[model samples]
Target: MFNKMSIINKGILTHSFKNINRNFNKNPEIAYTIREKIPSPLYITTPIFYVNAEPHLGHLYSMLLCDIRNRWELLSGKQSYFTTGTDEHGFKVQIASIEKGYDNPKKFVDELSLTFKNLADAANVKYDRFIRTTDSDHYDTVKFFWNLLLKKKYIYKGEHSGWYSISDETFYPENAIEEKINIQTQRKMMLSKETGKEVTFEKEINYYFKLSEFYKDILKILEKKHDFIIPRSRQDELISELKKMGKLDDLSISRPSSRLQWGIPVPNDPSQTIYVWFDALLSYLTGAAYPSKKFKSKWPAIHLIGKDIIRFHCIYWIGFLKAANITLPQQVIIHGHWLSNGIKMSKSIGNVVDPIDIIKYYGIDPVRFFLSETSVLEHDGDFTEERLFDSREKLISKYSNLLMRSCGSNFDIQRALERYGKMNLSRIKMEEFPLFDKSVIEEIKQLQDELNQLAKNIGKSMENFNLHSVTNNFIRILSRSNNLFQLCEPWKLGELREHQDLVIYLSTETVRILSITMQHVIPELSNAVLDRLKVVRTRRTIEFARVGADEAYGASANRGGDHPITRITKRTSSYPDITIKHQKAS
Candidate 1:
């Protein structure tokens, strides 16, 4: 019995996966207990992207990870909502508008926002809502939230002075700023050690949030939920920061409108504007349609963000929610940055990897596969031409070649022979086949069990929001299928009259299983491969065999689809043999 279990927040099981079978004869008690639980609508969000720069590989990387998780949740029968957009309101936008020679801040942000939307579209990144901080409703939502804090006595007027970094849109204490000489200007200046950006001493009167009051409560929440942060490393970092600061300072939540004229005006005071961080963090609730009937189902959310902003999301955002009597995010998934050939990506260094360019040259699925499959989410990954080529080569030769040969397509076997000419292909073949040998059946059964186990592992990882583990499992299954293909030469097995159907059955089924799992990470490729294998729309799940095993492929004499997925001509191309060069910033 393969039970489709209903999992709540974390690993709280409303239904069990142990009794998978629908039948009652073998396990009556388990079947009776397997009542279907209403699928909870899942709300997932990415930090609204800043409109200061064009979308880069780092942006795409974060979006891709979130998009993949959302898609997987949907496939698993959960109603998932994914929201991503531009953080349009900030002092940074004002500076960008002036530099770009735009008189209207709205017009400048609109243009930059469209570029990000276009990039997401080009990459096949699916999202339910594209929210901008400048959205009209967002102003109301921010004000509503601010009023909630004020009503609860969590906000008050305050005067403060600190080292402010305009680029980071954050104020730092004296200890956080270090004196440095500007390379371009050749002048001594103070810069923030954390962000490496120039900071200026500033004083202003503004509204402040009572972050210090919630410090003890936040520590208790951390202790109660050990896995509140997706990776334990990020949780440890946040806890350490909290302990180091015996108490949190009250956070300045507004800026005087006289100095920064670009943000949302404070709820009642026209002279003051809501600070950027405070304004941007509320976009999550606004995007979820908070303070409305729809929000109840989506109050607590799962956020996916880059590791750099962990403190803001984990500490500041959580404290703000606690103060306002709002639900905190269920989980926060943090991933490391993308480096360009062992160096931090920067515009001045001119090494920022444009995901748009990568998509244009390598296609969308390949780029998604390269990023998700090759890179570890816990640590930074280097983006080099050679690494991209190496990943592409593996996909083409091992996975794609297996598909082509199994489907009896012209798979450039001569090229494959040249590449592996040294090793004897027959040595890898398994012995004794009554077509589907007892051992072969066991091996395939083992593969099926692994997929079932993956279903469980993926569920647990999603609960913890550990996408790294999910991706590694996807790669592991793909590797196992490729190994099985080598051991059983399906092309050679197709020669025998008795073994032909069984060979096709085994090969096509394996590809179908892989295709189903690949749908979330590389959807276009998954669909194309599924179409080639002729697996029906209904049979695209781990329990595919139970639903419609016979209909996995058509009875056509030529099993291959209309066109080969990977180009035979480009099969042997060298790595770093990129199809096109980066022409200009996208």
Candidate 2:
């Protein structure tokens, strides 16, 4: 009983916000030109990988997300900039260099950095810039930011005392302390693996950034931009807890010069070195050509990061930027950690899944698709080989089968169009056919409206970084489309020669709808739809709308009621079976 017009209006309302145009400039010069015309530029950055260890699936997950968003922005014609790279500062790297028998920090870090570069390359991330904390330009930028903060009185020399985890490169509060028995040492210790060490009752003088001052400001920002932190629940819980705490202490921003001297020197203070977090987080700006005229044009758009490090990205990073009077990023998309067998994957466990291993087992596309589909943008999600296999079978197989079958066995683009065009001729004169269902047009419109609403809801979830809901909605839509196809029995109609046009019309329209629905998640599949329809690339030109009323045989009035002879073909055996083989050699 839903009016088709009302449904259309509702659908439009739901998805209208998602229609923001992206200005993609493949050439940096062209991107600069486009930046001048755009109201705002979108800058994105991935967390810099520490060079102490090799890249893992968790690292790839973060980078791939940035890549996906970058690609989407490009496809939408947005002037987008993306960055990813290595954090080469810290005692760990210093110790690692010595342990590797490399006298020079640069040489040791460079070797480790290559592993990250190769991993990113294998993942097909088209980052505009790859930053290395050791880069002279990056060093200057970090120092400049630090000096600016210091001049603004936001930084001070202070004595810091806390549990520092070298592994996590983080300090833990009293609450985070865990009493564990060190079997090897035969002693009880309050330790945090996240910090990579036990709490020693000691204090040291170090540079500190005054983050507590912005507690209220951060809260206000969160309130104003509810969508800034995704998976509303995580944002709500995290922000609420912070507000209750009322204040945060200043953060330590330096490492002892004697212990590790391979980092950027503190401005006007050669004896002190910038902390790991300070240098690493600054890569976001440095990678985007910050302080340069080009960087001023495009500042911060969205920051994609793992949930484990949300505190640093969302809190400290924002505080630092605010202290410097710089613009905060539009959004911080926090994704949950990927657990293997219900436990965090670690080198000690020998359970860390290398992204390359998965890529070698599958192809890049399948691995990318599986990760994106399984990752819940705001909550912890499990990553298993079995889950990846199932995703491949369900999403890839079914989707690919739909494409091959819909376009016919020949796979010739021109032939498929011709066949579709012929069917459209019959549907042009629907009034003349006695058996033609006129009410079906209304049903199709209603369904389109429902699809629009679903798309809008999904878009909002995506905007808020609630990828779990996005995947859930995607699966629901796919199920509905499959059910609708089964009930319509377009294959049966192919048997009635006279109704051939009607079958083509319904099938093409259904395919169009399915194709448009996939634009956000599986754009590769959507591209296939555009190719099949032979439509020229145009902005906001949906696949479903490309096939006009004339092409829809159901709308025709000239077609006779007489049924034509069914031309049966062996090729029309349900859907094609798409085989997905592992890329790894047996």
Candidate 3:
């Protein structure tokens, strides 16, 4: 009964070549599980946006990438929770609201925060909770963390003298400060845009977090857990610089109530309010349903942020967590600033891009693909309309073209099955199909190997957020698959009677590979490909099959095989109509 099993299995068996190579040195005695056991209530968060400004391309890129990761984990059978929202309490927000003639900070912040929520909705970001720093729950949580730290002697009162940028919501040392003179007013300015004016305030006494105490521990953590930060070079540089400095001064954790009344008040003292960093970073906990017993299970995962704030995330955030006796996030993924046409993207430069506008014009998938593709996780890259247009074209050619050819061919096969009855005349044996031939069988094996290697590389890159290499590799594989389709001419073969079975075999295999690759970037397209292939949607794990029995025979023979063929007949056209237009006749 099973003698022909091996004989009829060659085509389906070839798909396992990559899997076999991946586990080549593993012992057969113990089965290694590829999936990790996900703890319940998984917590993931993006840096909360400040409501002082509207959303931009840089903000969208970080949030959308985090959304993609969240969705992927959910699809992979993990209980995932994602949190994103705006920081409503800050000196900048206070100043901006006052400038708008709004006396009530809550009302003003509520209006500004909605813009960020709308942007998330536009991008299809499914955050479990949208945290507002001004929300009572988040305020309480921030107070709780602050009191805990103070009681532990990790916080103390001090006088902080520094140059602060209101626009940036950051304090700079004397060396880091830039000076500017107002030509019209004929006055020297410190360029603190948060106040929207150049004004220097003298030093003030405030509560400060003891950041220097955890300096050694932070360096040790970085050294021991190198994977804790993405882009190893960035991590090394951060750790090295911090070590050279030896210790940093305690961070001021409060703003005078008179200066910024919009912030959360310090727990023990009503005279001051918590600083923006103290309140904003606490969103990670509040958004996670923190202080609940369930949140402890999913305490840490990853933190995604821009390179400008790497020191805050990699150093200050870690120090705070360590002092609070909380588990640090698994990794800090840093990405470079998004520049426009070789200049920093800024409204003053007239080069600022709105993320919502891009999505509306180019579609969500293309925008997501472009950001991931053009961005190098470790270093900065320029964002240009030309680059986005080029990436969009490549996506259409590589994945979209393969999708149409594979499924369209499968549609043809289903029609044949309907006319000819279940294909029973198996003309070729599994062993007779050489794994190295230029035929469909060999191509399937090669694609499977390439895809698996790509996945592994992506995994390694993700350990330090090296997105440029990962996205580039995806493009390369997509190009190779497209070239394969053209050379084999599977569409031409589908029309011939003698080559009918071969066409069905090739089409089904192609659809399988396309479906798997699409799962990573464009999931909706992947689903459309699966539906076209006539595969029943089930909980059965779909592993990429490199080699398999040719579809010369239907699902009748050994339907119980590891790789079973299930017929799918329902079809709806879901692919994009991508037409390239030339601006001028060449």
Instruction: State the RMSD for candidate 3.
Output: 12.4
Instruction: Quote each prediction's TM-score.
Output: 0.83, 0.77, 0.77
Residue 86 accuracy (lDDT) in model 3: 88
Which regions in candidate 3 have their CA more than 4 angstroms from the true location?
1-42, 178-201, 408-411, 414-444, 451-473, 491-504, 539-586
Residue 465, model 3: lDDT of 47
Superposition error at 234 for model 3 (Å): 1.5
Compared with the true structure, model 1 gives a TM-score of: 0.83
Candidate 1 lDDT (Cα, 0 to 1) = 0.72
* Per-candidate total of colliding backbone pairs: 5, 22, 17
For residue 145, model 1's alpha carbon misses the true position, in angstroms, by 1.0
Q: Provide the RMSD of all predictions against the true structure, rounded to 1 decimal.
A: 9.9, 11.1, 12.4
Give lDDT tens digits, candidate 3, residues 1-586: 1123243343333343334335434521111112123333446678888788788888887787677676655554446677788888888888888899998878888887898899888877788788888788887788777877887789998888877666666666544445687778987777643234344555877898888788789889999997788777888998778777777767888888888788888886888988898788878878754654334445675778877777778878888888876778878777777876666665653677778877776666677778877777766777776667777777666655555554452335544445433333233444543332445555555565565454445546544444566568766766766676666665555345434444444445554544554454555556555554554455212233232422232333212222111222222212211122212321
TM-score of decoy 2: 0.77
lDDT of 2 by residue, 56-127 (tens): 888898887787766655544446778888999888898888888998989988888999989888877778
Candidate 1 ranges with C-alpha deviation above 4 Å: 1-39, 181-187, 409-445, 462-476, 490-500, 545-552, 557-559, 562-564, 567-586
RMSD of 2: 11.1
Q: Candidate 2, which segments miss by more than 4 Å at Cα?
A: 1-38, 173-178, 182-186, 192-197, 409-461, 466-498, 509-586
Instruction: Please name the candidate that would achieve the greatest TM-score relative to the true structure.
Output: 1
